[model samples]
Target: MNTQLQVKNNTNELHHILTRLENESTRKEDLIIPARNLMFHEDGFIYDRSSNKIDGYVLNEWATGQFAQKTNIPSKYFRQCPPELKAVNANHWIKELSSDEDWMLRTMRSRDGSPGVVRGIMSDKYVPFDDIEILNILDDVLAKFNKDYEIEMWNRGDTGCHLRVTFPDLTTSVGKLTNGAPDIHRVGFHMMNSEVGKSSIRITPMVYRMICTNGLMGWDTNGDVFQQRHIYLNHDEISNRVTGAIGKALKLGDNMINDLLKAKETEIENPYDVIDQIAKDNKYSQKLTGIIHESFDRERGNTAFHVVQALTLASQTLNADSRTEMERKASQVLNKLVVGL
Candidate 1:
């Protein structure tokens, strides 16, 4: 007797097949993991997510993001890279095949935005030096390249060291290089800010560099291969200070001008109050009284110029003393306004 074979379509069978396919794909193809999970070996090779595989390692998205952030590279470009490929490409070790460190030194010096080319000399016989010592050597080599720019070190996450150079123009540029390697890459921007009425402008600049090196064990690195710098202006604070200065200058009026001069040695809360008291005691004109009242009203948006214009129009029908006082106050306020700007 022959037996017939039956096909099973059970939920458990379907789930098992799907899980197997996922595992196979992940194992065969490059698996993209978060930067936080990455662990670097002593030889400079990175550990893959699966302990069994050496090639399937995680990449540094945060380092790449830091590069994008400092260089002002568009977010669209970073997002364009495949998530797995981005991780691998960003975190890969830089292996220097050539015995000549000239290429690396020339690249860093030329990009430093300094006056001349900077040359690097090998201090020790070892191919892979300590990351900290290498950074110090790079700093010394680049220092002669740009005397006007200030160079500093930056560390982005666990990736590597960043060489930041600030220029006199208030602009900064960062050089991104692997922490312990000599490979160099760069990125950054310029920024400017100014008060609405101020004559001066504040500027800031940034740059980036990336470094990598090869040796017997593999590639080792130290600093950030990416970096950024920016300048900020407090516009609201400037405006407030200007407004206060203008208001203080307006309180210098004839009725209180003498009193103010007399009490200039003393600190008075409201200068306008001194003027108002004098106007009431001397039976000042209604137009003058109205002008003083209007000037003192903090709620009104009337600038000193507007107050003067109104006073001038009403002065034609008022006494000489009141007219002269309004004209004097208006002139003083106008001068203050122009100078404040």
Candidate 2:
């Protein structure tokens, strides 16, 4: 058979099987994650009858916990589900596990939805860039920065990859310093591989603050980040897209540094008053307010620049919903103060 004909046949077959699985009353309890690895059983009821229907089924809590610990899925969803058992309620729990980067889904069924003796397979391995490709990309970009920047690999695991290229001890003076200011800041660009809803790669820009040492992405309102996704595995086209993005990313980094330098020029005579006003205006939590105060003291003084840094630090600690809110609020506050508000 032709490749196209075979592909169409496979699609129709999968749909037919899934329809049966969805309709079968007993299949709900019998359906496992390919192996007996995970089973959805009736809660607190013993399986004493062959024809017993599953009114409601939950994942085996203890078994799922053990599986999570072994597979390391528990930590990945730490913010969403600190307790691994709660992950059962998450959307498509079995599907997510089956589609995990490190594992594949297996099944034992025929094209007509019969209980075949042999098991089949469904694999999910959709990495845009492998280790060799990533290394080559970094090599090309690092040469653009010369030997002035330091390279750090934060993560290069199964899920995603991150690289931070920083220019050490390179900073612009913020505000007029009469008593000799400190040079403790550095500027950098963060390159990462992130997928939006497991769909496509979304290109983004990050700003690194020395005080908190947080590399926050999508904080700037410059619209410098470009979002792109590869529809096909065409190496040349993919490389070209990334190469073009690299040039734009460097320009965006420069623009971000320039903006920070401009903010530094607008000095605040009473730093405490401005900080207090920001806290009250934004209704910052008590914990966040305390952290901001600690950051102010740790940085050893206050300027418009320090205020930006402190708030950015606070945003890092916030929950996802609040973090986005804080990023917006910080921008508004900084814009007002930058023009001597």
Candidate 3:
């Protein structure tokens, strides 16, 4: 006997495939980040979301607003910024010009027939640095440490430019408490412009979370960063400074490796205790505390390494200044856990 084969509906199959393709093509959500609002104060200063004040003196409201617009920070934040945020002083906003005998200012009649004192000329020259030049400098410096160094990401906007370079050769993985859960370390360079209204380059020592690929950048030591002024464009000086910074960073990285190894060996049955201690010892924000708790809960085991990783991930969510403070506190907490060991 001969059997007849039945064919499925070709039209229906084609329609289903087309629908799936369409869904895949339009799945991405459009995300828009708003510009930061910088506040301008009557006393001539700008402030971001922090309580600290920027060291800029505005001679008039028009100048202050111009500075605020240029800086792009909210007016409220700048006005309410606290004194602690104030640096001793900075000439970042000020510009110097050479005296030229040929240049002369046109005569201006003062309002109300009164003579006004000359306030001097505003600077017209603003120094510019090529982003590529800065990256080349980083490339030269990072190559000495790791030949495999490569730029992982690049971001730029009104805030300024940011380049993240990764060093695959200088990585470390350690896990003694949980045999399968090894925390990985990836060293890199995070070079950027307009970091706190100044150009800077730094050794970005970030840890990789085993579960999630979050680059925990809460451990940027003071010794790792080098800030430079645009006006002082000295390649030799910058190269020398970068060389010294790299040496210090290598030493810091070695110490971190040792500390992480110790952390892996140290056991903690209840990781929440560490989180609680950290929260109490250092007035951590609710958001930071919440992230820490989540990190501990998500971690597979109770170990000092996991606790440190958790805290590190939490610190990344903080604002620029707060992240630095949290990283220092986390370091202190981790150190306390393995003081003798």
Q: What ranges in model 3 sit over 4 Å off?
A: 1-74, 77-132, 143-146, 152-157, 160-162, 176-182, 195-201, 204-211, 214-222, 225-233, 268-270, 280-282, 316-329, 339-341
* Model 1 ranges off by over 4 Å: 1-130, 151-153, 169-341
In Å, residue 339's CA in model 3 sits off its true spot by: 4.8
44-162 in candidate 2: lDDT tens per residue?
A: 21121223322223223333343444345563452345333444433234444543333222212334643321111112333333324543555555565464555422333222344
Lowest lDDT 10-mer window, candidate 2? 1-10
| Residue pairs with backbone overlap in model 3 | 37-73, 37-74, 38-73, 38-74, 39-74, 39-75, 51-82, 52-85
Q: Tell me the tens digit of each residue's lDDT in model 3 across 45-137.
A: 433333332223222323333333444445455435453332211122211212231111111223354432111112223233444455556
In the range 31-141, model 1's lDDT, one tens digit per residue, is 233333344443323443434433323223433343334234454675576655544443442221223322111101122333221112111221322223323333343
Give lDDT: candidate 3, residue 241.
Answer: 80
TM-score of every model versus the real structure: 0.16, 0.50, 0.53
- By TM-score, the best candidate is 3
lDDT top scorer: 3
Clash count per candidate: 42, 0, 8
